[model samples]
Target chain A: MPQPLRYLQIFATFARNSLIRDMTFRANFLIEFISSLSWVFMNLGFYILIFHYTPSLGRDTGWGKYEFFVFTGTALMINSLAGMLFMTNADNFGELIRRGGLDFVLVKPVDTQFLVSLQRVDWSSSGNFLVGLGLAVYSLRCLGVWPSPVTIVLYVFYLLCGVVILYSLMFLLAATAVWLGRNETLFDFWFYIVSFGRYPMEIYEGRFGRPFRWFFTFIIPVLVAINVPSRFLVQSIRPQSLEEWLLPLYTIAATVIVFAVCRAVFQLALHSYRSASS
Target chain B: MAAIEIRGLSKTYRVTRKKEGLVATLRALFRPEYEYVHAVRSIDLTIESGEFVAFLGPNGAGKTTTLKLLSGIITPTSGEARVLGHIPWRRENAYRRRFALVMGQKNQLWWDLPAAESFHLHQQIYGIPPDQFTRVRDELTEMLGVRQLLHRPVRELSLGERMKMELVAALLHSPQVLFLDEPTIGLDVVAQYTIQQFLREYQARTGTTVILTSHYMKDVVVLCRRVVVIFDGQIIYDGSLTNLVDHLGDYKIITIRFSDGQVPTDLSRFGKIILREPPRVRLRVARNEATEVIRAVLARYIAEDVSVEDPPLEELIAALFASARNSRLSQERGNSAVPEDTTHSANH
Candidate 1:
């Protein structure tokens, strides 16, 4: 078998093993799944109550009730994908470093980054992802917008781009654990940054909001993650000008660049690692 | 060819110094002080293929650090080493696939998963064929007497049982070189004996080169023919185990039993009285003077039985470390008048 195919096979094995491990604690898994879905439902309910007073998020931004739901759904999908794939592993990376558990990982013949990032799979997070996708489809129907096959394909592609961006960002934060010894606030910081990406980018148009929007859009590019994918779903909300079309292209480009940079940073961190002993 | 070779291998670490109190903690956040700790000093040694060598040292004497350097878990600050002609720190996949390192305190097995699952993971990581994997796995588990616990979660196993499983998992790849850092640590007497017996047999059968570090002298005495004693990050002694006892252990214990159940008051004239019981007394006699001391004792007192034996390896090693430490302290104090005895003992 080829090298890449062998890695995929190993990943499948890890997923299966993780499933078995999770199944051993059936009650805990169920509680986590239900709690995560409840959070998503509460967020949806909060937005629905807010839309009752205001017809749209912005006076002329066209982010009415259903359009905003699409954006919220896109945010949920991206966050859930990231939470399933790398959240738990990233959260535990510091403990592994401090306790010298990484010694075993380093000695293995497989790629250390691949093994650490994908070793654990949380099946509970998949529940939120499925609900998010359902909301996206439901909202699109409520708006009476039947997107063409091409538009749906583009939306899915951009959704994947959002997940890649979030994964790279969280991975970079986790890699800091190697240098800092313990980054206990990584999840809190990540949540704070990601919460900004939950709503439409046009909402940040005030004096402080303009700079915040510009910074997050160009520097971190979290705004483009949900905005481009959600906008592509509705005809009226889609990019009208050629410059607007560049947003999706820019999201792809930023994802590639950020992923490459994060991978390099992780390698550098490993090189500088001194095993836990003196 | 030598299975392992080293040239002035050294590892220095920068350790941050933290002072107590809130003020110091706050100040450290801005500027921290660091001290250089030479965990492994420049030392050189070599071991031939299929050699079973014991690495003996006191706590914090750099035994585990040296093993870590050899296993490529941490890079050295200077110097070089090669195992089977491959630079260890380079950590090539082909090299890693041929060697294994097991640390007693640190576990490689997944806590929530069964040991068998971890064994399968190792199979994939090492790229072992299915048939060979099963064969090696069964053989190792059988030898370790852990075949029944293969499917049980690792967190539920007893320490000894878990350690057996760890050994089995490590050997599943059939690694050519094994670096065991305190492999029998924290095990009961029976468990330690079991592991030692299995290791002895396994090394004999496979001709695998093994370097083991242990505080348990029994592990060394039972399995290793050659011993390397390290002190203060340097090789202090390297030779056969018998030679080690002869070189460092200059005294033997002589136990005497009185026929009439009477204690001798002046037995100190024979040798150093180490112990005394109702009808039995023990004396520490110099190795060269044992025969004369026994002769004098026999002539002076009517003894029913007598036995002469070397001091336990544990005691001998502790004495050696104490002597080494004293000499180092004297040297540090610039006490030129104090003669250094450790060098002379090693030469003998």
Candidate 2:
């Protein structure tokens, strides 16, 4: 079916107005804004404390230890963008289905899936992205080097991949509403997984942690979005050969497959929805 | 030729069977028993093109279920049906684009935006050409008399106004078929009449095939000529509305008016007395017996006038269902698990 352009315009208008309405609750907005800033400060505070205790990467590793710590933290900051932006949609879709708000979408001419998943944007996430960028730039200055123009461009591409992996996995989880009904525990467990993508995969030094980061970096592909960019900007973090960049290459293919599967599962859920009886 | 063909169509829903309580819920979570409720049983029906058919039934009598099947909202458990030469449940976009379903209990209009936004949305969803979209949208608005309501938020409109706007949204694409489930429900008489009038004119102008289910007999009386009466998921009556009235020999009310405001002192000897006001009311009489009964009343009592009326449509429907219930009782009483009428409809 052709996209409903005017309807989408109206939908965006509604979403914008709703966001503005939330901003009107001055106390709540103030609370959330402060809490989110504090959250970023807390994550970095823990990192600086850890660096104070170990000075170098296991005392025998090659790169500047502080540079390594800050860069790995940059990966965490970029990955948080997924939480900051797309997570809201993934979280809301399952509830929307259970609540019959999905009926509102189905009666419309638009593809119900598109409306449900992208219906709202968390404009507040602009705060998380800015703070994260500032941290990355500060970490670069600590190394006394400027990232090449190519490195900056590669960072943006990786960020886009990060969003896709997040979107596809969330869509996959929300699609479970079709069979099991709404299960929010599955969605919360996803946020817990994002925490693992915070550091360099090498931190734990054991096979277990290696496979864990590898699962997220390749199988799920979220870690790649973060690790690839942070690895590039910090320079000594990534493998130096063209062949070692294969993981990021694998990410694009996996992103496509995840998206196709999400689309299929979401459509199946729509078909099975039994609307309320009169 | 038939525009719709339903052959041995049956639909059933599985309802979990368990006692009501948290304990039962937990127990059932592990080992649940389910009972099947046959919402619509195996039944064959055919509807020809350009026909306005009123589907009538008591609550849970499967009228809306049948309409849902015809509209492709739910797939049947068995058998097959076709609308406009397409299978509905497959939900091919082209087949979906050809028909519209208007449910009275739900609104397709966006609640916060002006109704026009939804119309434009339909324009894109159906891929309607620009010129045709404008022409049809304007024509529907004018016909439904909602030209002034285009700019108002749907939530602000009165029930009648909202319903008119809903009709405009449903018809913005000018579908060839319309399936309406209780389109006149919960509306004031004026609003109902306005909708009924608009529907009649729309059908007359476009010759669109309309299948509507309404509890209000007045709606069916004004809109549909042929009535399909379903009871217990079976099409017990299908033919002209007038014919069903005649063939369903149930009850007819007869009343007599006398110059002196007094009923005949003895009504029991004449017939069953239903109303006891000054002018007497008696139970309905069959055609053959009504003539003899009327003569006896005339000979024995003095009256200024007399009138015969068919029982209210609602009452007639209730009587049909009551009879169905009694038959089921008898079958259970006799413990007859044997199916009835297997020999009928030998062709299919």
Candidate 3:
């Protein structure tokens, strides 16, 4: 079989198995879905309260209440999809290292990164994904914007780029657990970094915010992930600057670079894994 | 060609050292101490295809480390090893597909899903053809008597049942070489025997080269004709299991049943009194002195029956380990018989 076909087959099996596993614990699975949806709702409610006081998120940022909603929805979709696919696997990578579970993975005739990253899907995050999709469409409708077919295509493609970026970043962090031995702080650091991507890059324009924006935009590329994709979908808004217009291309470049770097680091870490003795 | 050929293969781990007490903890937080542990000292070994070899050692003697190195789970600090014509640490996909490693303490199957689900996942991961996968899976499940438990969640199965499933998963790929690290750890006697029987029969049928590291002497005795005894990361003895006994077994057991149901009063004069019941007494006599001791015992008392036999394999192995420790200790100290204080465990 071709390599891609083989991997796709394995991934399909993994997804099916994960769904079965989730259904096996119906109560816990339902509770997780409810919990994720509740968190999204509360976040949306918080933004709604903020919009009531101010017409836009920031002064002259062009991100009106509904426009900002689009950005938030894009972020939600990106995070939800990434979390559903890679969150549990990345979080468990550390435990795998500590418990020597990775030994089995190393012996399998498959790409270690692919196996480690996509082995388990968090089905609960599907609820959050739906909520994000609803919010994006509802906000687009409220803004009275109908994007062109090209814009919609670009938006979907960039959303995938956004997901890949987050997966790469999370995988990079989890791979560090191999050397650190125990990286319980991985999610803590990830949460902090991802929080920067939640809001629009416009909010970061002041003396202190400029460098933060530059760091997150060009260096980490988290800002461009959701911002560019959401910008493409919100037809009423147009790129205000050359840099903003080129953000989509930059996001694509960043995804490729980040994923390649993650693969390299994960391989290096695997070489250093001292499998725990039985 | 040799299924495995290891030359001076070694693995050294750099471990952090922390002292006890709050002050030491604080000090370590600032300036941590570190030391190197030689998990596998430079050792050379070779095994041909279809050979079943047992790596016997106390805990931390580098048996599992060697297995991991062979399976390509971890790279060695130094030296070289090739499994099936591939350098293991290179981790080529072709090499990985041709071998499997199973650790009894760690599970590869999904905990929340049925074993059948994991088996199907394995079929996809290994890219096994549908017909071949079904045939192999059925054969393994039927042989292990786990066909009924395939649909049950793995967590719901007993330890023995779970281990049987693990074997099926490992064998589904039809690996040319199998590495088993304490595959029967933490199991009842019945379970252990069942697994041992399955492995023996499977090896016989498939002719796959297998290297197993097990603390259970029974596992070693029952499955392996070739045994390698390692101590302190070095191979101390390697040969047939029968030869291991012949080389280190210095004592025999003598059992004497008295005509009257009365215990011998001075049995120690002959040899170590291993057992002393009212009617029968067992003695551990030097192998060379068995004849004289038996003659002395028969003349000294009215015996109903007498028998002689080799000591249990466990005792011989324990004595071998004890003698090796003594010799090492004696060499370590300026004295001729300085023994290191490190613990040596024979879990069996």
On DockQ, the candidate that comes out on top is: 3
Q: Please state the Cα-based DockQ of model 1 relative to the true two-chain complex.
A: 0.63
Candidate 1, after superposition: displacement of residue A63 in Å? Answer: 2.4
Write the number of the candidate with greater lDDT, choosing between 1 and 2. Answer: 1
Best by lDDT: 3
Evaluation by TM-score, superior candidate among 1 and 3: 3
Q: After superposition on all CA atoms, what RMSD does each candidate show versus the true structure? A: 3.9, 5.0, 3.4
Clash pairs, candidate 1, are: none
A1-278, model 3: which lDDT tens digit per residue?
99999999899999999999899889999999998899889988988998889998767778998888888889999999999999999999999899989989988889898999999999999988888888889999998888889888989999999898888888889999988888878656887888899888888988999999999988887887788888887633656788876777788889999999989999899988988767
Instruction: Score residue B337 of candidate 1 by CA lDDT.
Output: 46
Docking class of 2: acceptable
For model 2 chain A, where is the 10-residue window of minimal lDDT? A101-110
The alpha-carbon deviation from the true structure for residue A46 of candidate 2, after best TM-score superposition, in angstroms, is 6.8
> Which is the winner by lDDT between candidate 1 and candidate 3?
3
Write the candidate numbers in order of decreasing lDDT: 3, 1, 2
The all-Cα superposition gives candidate 3 an RMSD in Å to the true structure of 3.4
